[model samples]
Target chain A: MEERTVCEMCDNPPEDEGYELPLCANCRDELSRCPFPLWVKLISGLVLLLVLIAFVNFPSSLRAAAAFERGNKAKSKGNYPTAILEYERALARFPDSTVTMAPLAAACGWDGDLRKFAYYLEKLDGREIRADLADEIEEILLEFEDLSEMEGDEQ
Target chain B: MIIPGRLIALVTFPGVIVHEIAHQLFCRLCGVAVLDVCYFRFESPAGYVEHEPPRRISQHVLIGIGPFIVNSLLGAFIALPSAVAVLQFEAGTVLDYILVWLGVSIAMHAFPSVADAKSIWQAIWSEGTPTLTRLMVTPVVGLIYLGALGSFLWLDLAYGVVLAVGFPYLLVSLLT
Candidate 1:
């Protein structure tokens, strides 16, 4: 014998098929509403909005990071011009980023752009930087020094 | 070591609320009827979604794991810029801290509850359950139990940190 099915909530004939819960369209809609408290709705809505904002803003940051990566790769490969360009691109997206700035300064120094390198190095003075980067910068500065003018009498 | 779940839920209420929402949303998506739901409360369970048993194993799996997918992605996305700025670039604002907190709070609750594992186990082991499902899903259930056990050691908090903060750092590092 064929059995008849009915809505579990309203006890009416089911309107939608393929549902494990025997509910008509109206009851299904009602259940979907959830009736969560107002604050929960507000908070969840706020979260979704914030996440959307972040997602929207993410591409720029991602591009900046990618550009920074390209810069590092270029610098390592002695492609100083490409590295400088990529670093500039990253700086455009992430302005005043010390990490990017330090690397940019180092790249300029390696490329022998003394004017730009000295400018960046002077700007970085007294700024807290990674020890290794500080050492690299110091070495770059030493490259400009004359050995005879040095006061080291240990020779 | 045996602190109540309610206290933890109260502290991380956002995660609890989102977890319940994820469950309800999946139920709606699967065309299942939700009998009841509590997004958050100062109770033993903290939050819950009562819904009809799904007709398919795939639906059940989705419903059980919905929070893991939603919370992880949301949390990680929410934390990405802030985490990278503060942790990697050493630059951030007050707003970044707030966003990081929210992200960590959400990610902290990504694991499926042990009860969800038990239900899935029952469904998979029941009569007529496909062999493929049994093989594929058992590991998930095991992991859920392990997660439940690890919660005693605050592994959930660590998981949150790794997902929401560490992931973005890893992403940036990989690109470089």
Candidate 2:
């Protein structure tokens, strides 16, 4: 009698194509896709998660931080218009951030846009402002009021 | 000594069925010819899907790990409502417990078998494999082995519990 070889998986004797680690035909078929590469599936899954997050508009603090950084860079370069736009974008993401509001008010003041400066200052009025920025804002508001009075006198 | 593979299979039949179904589903989606499918058997694996190898290595990879993706997601989804009910102190019906069991079973089977890890390694080293493929497959192979080892420590059950309970709890907290 020919010796029967056992399958590694189910321990069934191989009826055909018997060899070392002899898998029965059924077991061999089952093992055909063994050691399936998981990385490909994981990458695809991660891509799906990113797409889902994008669709869901998940709140991302990183986005707010990036916008804040862009605003700061623009402000430091004396580009008040770009700073204002970026600061507004940051504030839109993080609505209640005093850090964002302070920069926005400063940007508006630097741009000599009195109306927007007053708008942002009024928004900041009830909230506690940082000492340095508060001093600058007070001076800018006073200068704005003085200019407005001079224009009224001329009229 | 005879290994109690059949007994284990009987105990976790839902997982076996979902796992095989996931494989078949991926094979169909990948356009691979499904030669055979055993949804359940008295034998060791309990269930399996036999399909022709896909033309692209990527497709092959997809077919192999497809069960993990399908089972985990399906398990989590099915468990959501039951988890919510249980958290709210509602006396869930027998069907709810069954759903929770089914979900956890499916999730527990989400880890690919050791054979799957080997297949992925082979695919990674196969001829004409892209550099990107090698880069991506390396970490996955490591994780697959890790998960396989974790199974010995009941990490698979832990993973299932997280999906069935932790995820639902998180969703509820977020909404409220």
lDDT by residue for model 1 (A1-155), tens: 54448876777898655555677888877776666678877876886676666566566777777788899899889898999999888888767788888988998988888898988777777788878878887787787564434645546
Quote the lDDT for B13 in model 1.
84
Question: Could you tell me how far off, in angstroms, the CA of residue A138 lies in candidate 2 after the best superposition?
Answer: 61
What TM-score quantifies how close candidate 2 is to the native fold? 0.51
Interface RMSD of each: 4.2, 14.5
Residue A84's C-alpha lDDT in candidate 1? 92
Clashing pairs in 2: A34-B115, A35-B115, A35-B116, A35-B117, A35-B118, A35-B119, A35-B120, A36-B116, A37-B120
Q: What is the C-alpha RMSD of each candidate to the true structure, in Å?
A: 5.2, 14.9
Instruction: Give Cα-based local distance difference scores for all models.
Output: 0.81, 0.71
Mark the regions of model 2 whose C-alpha exceeds 4 Å error after superposition. A1-155, B1-6, B87-90
Prediction 2 global C-alpha lDDT: 0.71
Alpha carbon deviation, residue A96, candidate 1 (Å): 2.1
State the weakest 10-residue window (summed lDDT) of model 2 chain B: B84-93
